[model samples]
Target: MLVDGHHLLYRAHFGFPRRVTGSSGEDLTGLFGFVALLRKAHREHCPGQEVFVVFDAEDGAADRAENVPGYKAGRAGADHSPVVHLPAVKQALDAAGVRWLEQPGCEGDDVLATLAKLAVVTGREVLVFSGDRDLYGLLDGQRVRALNTQLPAGRQLVTAADVADRFGVHPVQWPDFRALTGDASDGIPGVAGVGPVTARQLLAGGRRLEDLPETASGRAGTGLARARAQWQEVLAWREALRLNAHVPVPDDLLTGRPTPGLVPAGQLLTEAGLW
Candidate 1:
C-alpha cells in the first residue's frame, strides 16, 4: 500500500484532539492517529502487504505554482500548526520500520502516482491509503485503488468505477472533471458560472475541453456560458490536475514487493517514548 503522508497526517492531527501527548508532554495527536490508521489499514486492507509512505517537500507543488500563480495559495494562508506534528509522525513511522520518502520538488500524490504506475508495469497491484480526492485520477480500477480510513461513513476502497459512478467520469477523465469544476481548496477558481452538471455536460462524449468549444452542442451549451467563454482556464486547470507518472524514484526502491512494517504500532509508540 502507498500512503500520502501529509494527507493522512493532517487528517489524523485534526481528527484526533490535542488531548494526547508523549512522556515529554509533546503533542502526540498525529503520532497516535497516524499509527492507528496505519495499523487498521494493515489489519483490514493489507495484512501482508508492504507499505510505502510519500511525504511532500516544503515546496512540493512549486512547479504547479509556476504555471498558475494561485495554485494552492489558500493553503499558505491557512493554519499551519498541523505541520508541527510531522516530526513525531515520522518518528513513529521509523519506530515501526515503515519505509517512506520525501522527495525534493515532488508532491506526495505525484510520487504515489509514479510508484503506482511503475508497480503496475511490474504486474503488481497497489492500494493507496489516502483521502485526497485528487488521487482518484490515478485509479486504474484493475491494478490501482485508493483506500480511505478517515471517512466517518466507514472506510471505502475507491476504484475507477467509484469515480465514474460518483462523478459520471472515468479515472482518465478525472483531470478534465476537476478542470470544469475547479478546486477551491487548491485556489483554482473554476470557470465562472460552472458547476458539476455543466462541467459533466461539457466533458461528456469523450470530448476534451479544447475540442468541446468546437462542437455545436458546446458552442450552444445552455448553462455556464461564461465558463465556455473561459475555456482556456478550464484547460489549464485540467493540465495542472493531471498526474505525472515519471517522478523518478530510485530503481533500488522498486523491489517488486513491499515489506510491511509489522511491529505493532503500540510498540512503536512506546519505543518513541510516546506511550
Candidate 2:
C-alpha cells in the first residue's frame, strides 16, 4: 500500500477532534492522528502488505505552477500547522522500521503514481491511500485502486469502474474531466459556464477535448463552444492534471517482502520521547 503523506497528515490534523500535545506542550495531534490512521488501515485491510509513504518536497508543485500561475494558489492562505508535524511523523515511521520517501522536485501523488506503476509492472496489486481525486487517474479496477478510507465499510476501495460510474469517463480521461469541471481545491478556474453534466456531455463517447465536435447547440454545447474559444488554456489544464508515471525512483523501493506489523502509535511515540 502507498500512503499520500500530506493528504493523510492534513486530514488527520484537521479532522481529529482534540489536540494532542507532547510533554513540552508541542502540538502532536498531526503526528498522532497520522500514525493512528495509518496503523488502523494497515492492520484492518493490509496486514501482510508492504507500506510505502511518499511526501511532497517543498517545491513539489513548481512545474505545475509554471504552466498555470494560479495552480493551487488558493491554498496559500490555508492552515499549514500540520506541516510542522512532518519531522515527528517521519521519525515515528523510522522507529517502526517503515520505509518512506520525499523526493526533491516531486509531489507525493507523482511519486505514488510512479511506484504504483512499478508495482503493477511486477504483477503486484496496489492500493493508493489518498482522497485527492487526481490519483483517480491511476485506477485500473484490477491491480490499481485508491483506498477511500473516508467511504463506508464495503465501498472503501475506488476502482476504475467507480470512476467511470461517478464521472462518466475512464480513468485515463481524469485529467481531461477535471480540466473541464475546474477543481476549486487546486485553484483551477475552469472555462466559464461549464459544469459537471456539461463536461460529461462534451466528453461523451470517450472523446477527449481534441475529439469534441467543433460546432454544437444548447447550453452545454454553448459551454463547449466557449471552452473551444479558449482551447489552449483547457488543453494546458489537462496536461497539468495528467500524472507522470515514469518518474525515476529507487530500485530498492520494493523488495517483495511484507512489512512487519507496525508498533502501536502511542507506544512508538512514547519510546521516541515525543508523547
Candidate 3:
C-alpha cells in the first residue's frame, strides 16, 4: 500500500474535529490525526500489507507549473497549518519504523504511480491511499485500487469499474475527463462553457480529447467545436494532469514483507520524544 503523505497530513490537520496540543501547548493535531487515520486504515483494510508513504518534494509542482503556468496556484496562498507539523509527523513515522520517502522534484502522486505500476508489473496487487482524484488515473481494476478514506467506508476503495460507472469514462481517461471539465483544485480553467455532462459526452466511448471529432452539432458537440480554439491548451492540461508512472525509484525500497500494525498516535509521539 502507498500513502500520500502530505495529503493525509493536510486532511488530518484541517478535517480533524478538535485541536490537539503537546505538553508544551504546541499544536500536534496534524501528527496525531495522520497516525490515527493511517493506523485505522491499516488495521481495518490492509493488515499485514506492506505500506510505503511518499511525500511531495518542496519543488514537486515545478515541472507541472512550467507546463500549465496556473497549476495549483491557489494552493500557494492557502493555509499551511498542516505543513508546520510535517517534521514532527516524520519523526513519529521514523520512531514507529514506518518507511516513508520524499524524492526531490517529484510529486507524491507520481511516485505512488511509479510504485503502483512497478508493483503491478511484479505481479503484486497495489493500493494507493489518497484523496487526490489525479491518482484515479492509476486505477486498473483489481490490480491497482485507490483507498480514499475520505469517502464512506465501503466506497473508499475506488476501482476502474467504479470510475467508469460513476463518471462514464474509463480510468485511463481520467486526466482527459478532468482536463475538459477543469479541476478547480489544480486551478486549471477548462474551456469556458464545457462542464461535466459535456465533458463526459465528449469522452464517451472511452475516447480521449485527441480522439474527439473535429466538427459536429448539438450542445456538447458544439461545445467541443468552440473548445477547439484552445484544444492545444486543453491537451497540455491533460498532460499536466497525467501521473508519471515511470519515475525512477530505488529497487531496494520495498522489503517484500508485510508491515506490522502501526502504533497509536500518542504512543508514537511519546516514544519519539516529540511531545
**What overall lDDT goes with each candidate model?**
0.79, 0.89, 0.88
Rank order by lDDT, top first? 2, 3, 1
Query: Could you give the candidate ranking by TM-score, starting with the highest?
Result: 3, 2, 1
RMSD of candidate 2 to true structure, Å: 1.1
Could you tell me which residue pairs clash in candidate 1? none
Compute each candidate's TM-score over C-alphas. 0.91, 0.97, 0.97
Clashing pairs in 3: none
lDDT of 1 by residue, 140-245 (tens): 8669989986565453888888777778778888888787778888778887656777777777776666656544355336545666677677767887888998
Q: Model 3 residue 252 lDDT?
A: 79
Q: After superposition, how far is residue 163 of candidate 2 from its true place, in Å?
A: 1.1
lDDT of 1 at 254: 62
- Ten residues in a row with the worst lDDT in model 1? 214-223
Q: What is the C-alpha lDDT profile of model 2 across 131-235, one tens digit per residue? A: 889999999978999996888999998999998898899998888888988989887888888888888888888998888887677977798888988889998
What are the C-alpha RMSDs, in order, of all predicted structures?
Answer: 2.3, 1.1, 1.0
Model 1 off-target regions past 4 Å? 152-155, 213-224
lDDT of 3 by residue, 124-236 (tens): 99889999998999999899999998898789999999988888899899988888888999988888888888888888788888789776667887779767989889889
Q: What TM-score number comes out for model 2? A: 0.97
